[model samples]
Target: MHTKKVIIVAQLFISGMMALFMSGVMSVIHMGFTAQWFAQWGPNFLTAWPIAFVASMVVGPIGFAMARIVLRVEDAV
Candidate 1:
């Protein structure tokens, strides 16, 4: 939890889970879950996780700002 807000926590969870599952499926699709599946997936997941986490951190606030303006929503606690 640390000092993370609700928004940040939600963003992390959503982005992380999405990336994990998507990468898993995509890796399997590319390699058919063969003997090399984890071997391949490890590298791919390692590459994707950081990018996804950083992207989520960067994009979440921007998207939230846009939504607030567009929908005239009050900032939530």
Candidate 2:
């Protein structure tokens, strides 16, 4: 198993990237590539990042556990 510090850092990076891309994509889909669309994405990302981080922290372990089960990777191994 990975260390808690490593998992937190990974989650921070993962959540930030996910929030950035998702906010941008959703903005584009909703408003197209206008000046306003570009303007909104930054704020959206800022708002989303924290929520994303918390959600990822909560869900990450469960998701990893499910993946390990599916892949038959033992935690002890």
Give TM per candidate.
0.66, 0.94
Candidate 1, 23: how far from true, in Å?
A: 1.2
lDDT, candidate 2, 1-77, per-residue tens: 78899999999999999999999999999999999998899999999999999999999989999999999998884
Q: Cα miss at 63, model 2 (Å)?
A: 0.6
Least well predicted 10-residue stretch by lDDT in candidate 2: 68-77
Q: Rate the local accuracy (lDDT) of all candidates.
A: 0.80, 0.96
In model 1, the runs with Cα more than 4 Å from the true position are: 1-12
Q: Which residue pairs does candidate 2 place in steric collision?
A: none
Candidate 1 C-alpha error for residue 54, in Å: 0.7
